[model samples]
Target: MQCDICQRSPSSRLPFNCTLCARNTLYQPRIQLAQSLLQKEALEKEVDQNVAGTPKPTRIIPAPGGKPSEPNPSWIVQRAAAEQIVSEEKTQGIHDHVKTLREEIQNTKAEIAARKARLQKRRSEFASAKQELSKSQTGAVENMDKSMRRTEHRWDILHNKTAESRLFLCREAALLYGLHQRKRKKGGLGRDVYFVGGVPIADLRDLNSMDSFDYGLRQADSSIDASPAHVTTSNTNLAHLVHLVSHYLSLRLPAEITLPHRDYPLPTILSPGSSYTGREVPFPGSTPSHSSNNSPSASRHADQRSLPRPRPLHLDKKLSALAKDDQVAYASFVEGIAFLAWDIAWLCKTQGLNVGGNSWEDVCAMGKNLWQLLLAPPPRPSVSREPSSKTPPQKPSLSRPSTAAARTLQPENPKDVPPLGHFSHGTAYGYLATASGTEYMRDWGLQHPLRVIEKVKAMLLAERTGAEWEILEGNEWEEEEAGSEAKKETKKDVVRPGIEETVILVRPGGVESGINEGSGGTEREESDGKGRGASGWMKLKSR
Candidate 1:
């Protein structure tokens, strides 16, 4: 038969007790005790009957059966012995059960204690892990905060530099326009002069209306006062700056016809040597590239005569793509070009030169030639070649344009310059509207770094401040002339401001660098303790 509790087949060799039947066996102790009491009662009754009321007259019929062994005294003695043995056996069984129960109790207590100790150990481990996790999270947060701070610092530096550039360009354009206006008044050119687009010069919008520099300056100063350490611009501020510059340039150069100077400032910062150097060298394969036999004087003379070549003014396709992707940057680049053109025009007008013309080719040619003179190299013997079977040896000419030579040449009249064609608005603005053309122009604009704006501003600031003076005395004329020629040579070259000339650090007072703006200091002291003296340009602060 199957057991009821465990549902297993019962074993035949042992008792067929189920799990429930075994649990019910705990009542066996009471049953055993009852049975022992009953046996004792029965034995006592028999003994009483035999001892007190034994009326079973074993008459004299068995008188001969020995004296009946004294009615079996042996029976009473045996009964007493049996009773004692049963009592002792029952007591031993109870004692053994109690001992087994005590051992079980001890084993259970030990198990419970071990379980509690294990639980406490686990709890401590959990607590330590939790604490470590919290520490790690705190450290991660701190590291993130530090990273953000560094990124913010870098952004501030870039933003401030950009702001300064924008301000300098605006101020320069304004000053230059003012100068042009004054000269125009003096010459009777009339503000009503009609441009190729039929728009009167006077009709152009004034730059003063788009003065983001002043607004930004105020905000920057306020920010500096509020924090005195870190200052940043909102997107709104940056967009406003871009719009202001773009609008100003639009008004200044409304159309290509309204271009301040005929391709003035050209697309390149430097003019090419072969085209503008005014001298020619024999074909490359005809002669060796260098001659070791030339003396130091000859080499020096050659160096003085040779001007640095102009960088090609072509647009880089890759850079153009990058610029096109950034509309604001592209706009900034165009505006920068417009500012440079305006400045050049003003410079030419002040020198009593005509910059306006109708012929595109002529304008480009004139601008290039002008650049050659403005950035003339040190006086060198002009190279002239004589006819010979072999490549003619070149001879250097001594004649070079100087103040003396400049005084002799007459500037052309604008009226005499031929017009190429009627101005077309579509052609002028069309290129800018397209991606490819815009990118191309952007590439050209980037040829000149933004630092040029700083240089120009520094130059203008020095002139305005007037705290510095240049002395032309004694033999200083000859020396000055030579220096002036050298200066012109590097003008069109890719010249950049020295470290002393740039705003290296922003300070609470304003801006700080090694540049000294004061005029009274010794030459060495002015050049940051170097003997070179301060450069012609001085450093400027944003304010």
Candidate 2:
């Protein structure tokens, strides 16, 4: 059998189980009650201890025999209230924290937007700047290329012009001096030589080759070994030939050549003797001879005096030496060659020689012709019969207008009339006769080198200052003619004095007075005060 409290434990229990069960059953309820009472007391004590120092107006102590104390409604309500307050405070603090977080997020978003806008603006500005920089770089490159091309073009043009000028100079020199190339007998190589009337003056090697001359010129600035021996020889020969030709032309030409270095003296090809034999003299500073009879000072003075005067168209030193020593002197020497050529052509033209066209070839041909004529041998004089006994009949002189009448009747075209101081027919014919080899030996002898030099020097001082005198004088004559023509035109427009007309004035008292006035009637009216009298009426009639 099962016990009431344990259920089915008595059969398997020990011998004293029943008595112990009865005892446990009786005191179990009391023990349980006592435990419950003790727990209540402990809880009360704990509660009292918790409120020991505080005065509690809402608390009530229960009687010992009263029903077990119920939970205090006030205390429960207080606890709930405290919990609600804590929850509400936490919710409010959370709301405030959420609001602060929201504000911070909005500020961050605005700052990000502003930064994006600034970045976009910067990107656009950078793109525009890059485009501008690219365009500027392209433009600068194109401009630099254009400048280089322009500079090259200009340099080419300048180089071409310089080459043409040099070629023209060489052509003119060849023409003036009658330079020609002749084949040598042994080597078959051509040698350049210049002649005056077929008489050879100087032998030049390879002068016709401008390249060789330029090479020599270039080499002259450097060492002597830089140039070939033939080129140097050619240059030396050309310089000597130029000296001879210049001296010969200077002696014949009326005006001086006006070369460079008139103040500073140099060496010359002219000798100190009476005749110019084309001997090379020492430098102008050196003394060639000493005289025992004279004192040192007097001898020095005599030697200085005896030194030949510097030639106008000539160089003081050789061209190669000039090139090495002074560039200006070298350039002047080249210019002097051109001047000498021009002088020769001008002389031929002045003497009525036929100078052809402006081309260098034509000028060369003309120069050659003129040189032949000038250097030709005199024609032998032929025997003539005695003078005729009968006198030649005089021709009737034609009546001509006076100088003033001729000037008044000058032609409208000024070219039809000769300028003042123009060469006369007789002088032109005399030059023609001399050039045609018809002049007497004695007359031709007057044109000898020595005599011509003296005569030309005197005539140059008196008449000519430069080679362009004739050209300047012609231009001046043209200007004067133009002025004279203008004066003639103005004179035609002028009114001349004519027959006088007599005016008779009648006064108010019937007295009559006569006045003689020419074409200046307006002047008489302005001069006389009574001419405009209001009381008198005047009548005018033409006669």
Q: CA RMSD for every model?
A: 31.6, 37.0
TM-score of 1: 0.21
Model 2: how large is the Cα RMSD against the reference? 37.0
What is residue 154's positional error in candidate 2, in angstroms?
Answer: 4.1
* Top-lDDT structure, candidate number: 2
State the number of backbone clashes in model 1.
5
Worst 10 residues of 2 by lDDT: 463-472
Best-performing candidate as measured by TM-score: 2
Candidate 2 is scored at a TM of 0.25
lDDT of 2 by residue, 377-448 (tens): 012121122212222112111122233312322234444322211222223322323534233212222222
lDDT of 1 at 59: 23
Residue 491 lDDT (model 1)? 39
Q: Model 1 Cα displacement at 211 (Å)?
A: 23
Residue lDDT tens for model 1, 197-310 = 111111112111111212222222422211101111211121222223433333222211111123332232222113334343322123323444488875665634543332
480: Cα error in model 2, Å? 74
